[model samples]
Target: MKFYDFGDIIASDTEFVIFGIPWDYLSSKDNVNSSTAPQKIREVTKDLALTTEMGVEIPSLKVVDIGDVSIDPTNIERNLREIKDFLIAIYNQKKDVIPVMIGGDHFCTFPVVKTISKEFIADDNIGVLIFDAHLDLYDKWDKGVYSHATVSHRIYDLDQFNKNNLLIVGTRDIDIPEMKIANEKGINHFDAFLFSDLGFKNLSKDIVAFFQNSRIKSLYVSIDIDVLDPSIAPGTGYAIPGGLSYRELWQLLRLLAKNFKIIGCDIVEVSPNLDAPNKMTSNLAAKLLIEFISFISN
Candidate 1:
């Protein structure tokens, strides 16, 4: 099924355009299959309640699920080009629509972000906020430069992004090399453990303040499912402890939407194969996507 049974075409009044990236060949783990996430998440949405937790009717949201990008898993360059062109086509239809992406892996975010950033006449006021368990700051990984593990670094390498405008949060699992690179580049990330020390209110404010201080007005958020505690979201490749709770993230996203113009967003790395029999991870992914849409809509 399509996301919330939304239309398959983008119209003039479309506020959000939802699409999927079904390629995961760039993920570091061989056992985990995140490639199935986009479809699985869509399938679960059919069983969800028609209204959001805040009582907003889901059907009223101006969203269209245009379906997944055609991907050849082994062909990385071709997939990147296809994903970029797919987004370009969406903008060709409507420039003001917010693109919501459901992903195969974190690497899927790279192409979408790259394409969206280019659409801006001046990217100086744009910022990127990433929610993940690992820094994903490696310049290269087992599969080389284009791997999922190198996604953040690749984004940072973009001409319009820098330490001030790009922030990574909910990090707990950090490899020595990635940590060293993050430190050397002066990249700032909020570790998961800080939630306990700072509390949710202060932490959320600080996140907003980071971009505000940098004079960032347009924000793009990327969420890796593993950023949540493993007990609650175990369907991701890396199950790290000391992650954010569902409520925490929900409130944070609410605050973010209130504070900045969220131009585009993506939720990635949800490995349905590793989820419980109840399909909790996919359900959570679906919930987060819809709720965020609701927040942005209101």
Candidate 2:
């Protein structure tokens, strides 16, 4: 199934391209099958186009689905290299084409960000806007360097990723190691509690203003489904109790779209293996992508 499944697939002058990487080789100890997320999200959203409740009209935009990257789960180095090469080819195809990636796990983000920084935006300091429950900044988790837990650290090591421009939003859980790293690097952390305390309106105001004042003109957004409350998104590896409500996330994305020029985005960690019978997580993930496309269209 293809995302949007709109019509004749256009590759040139595309507004956005959807790429799927279906390999969950680097998640923590849990054996959740996040590799199934790309197809699950596409299955739910393939035939969708019109907004049901938001009343936001999306302008006709060209989108291409590049399908999934084949990976041998047993070979992490080879897989990462393949993923990076795939992204380089896509970005090289067009100057400003936005790549919307549906991930196998949060680990998939390292390659996407690394490729964008190294190949496309090497001259600019690119900012990363991450919405997740955990920081994923551990140097090593379960004795693994490239696991999903260490994505932030690996991305920071890349020469093109600006440490100060890194913003982790909607995080509610953090280990001491990750916390210290985030603090020392001066990465912005806007957790669930602070967002709620500030209320949506004030938080949106502050966040929008923050991005406007920052040095980054181009940004990449990485959203972990676990950033949402379990009641809304339970199909992730880690389900933290307190998280951004669906509406809260929607509002935040809307603000960001209005304030910043988002170059690309990825929605990761939608594990159908952990979803409820109704598959609410995948459905919501689909809607989030749709809403974001609509938001950026405006």
Most accurate candidate by TM-score:
1
TM-score, per-candidate, Cα-based: 0.98, 0.93
Candidate 2 worst ten-residue window by lDDT? 4-13
lDDT of 1 at 205: 87
True-structure RMSD for candidate 2: 2.0
- Position 155, candidate 2: lDDT: 81
Candidate with the greatest lDDT versus the true structure = 1
Candidate 2 per-residue lDDT over residues 271-296, each given as its tens digit? 99899988899999989987887777
List candidate 1 stretches off by more than 4 Å.
121-123
Q: Which residue runs does candidate 2 get wrong by more than 4 Å? A: 46-49, 52-59
Q: Model 2: how far is 127 from its true place, Å?
A: 0.8
lDDT (Cα atoms) of all candidates against the true structure = 0.92, 0.82
- Tell me how candidate 1 scores on lDDT: 0.92
Residue 166 of model 1 has an lDDT of 98
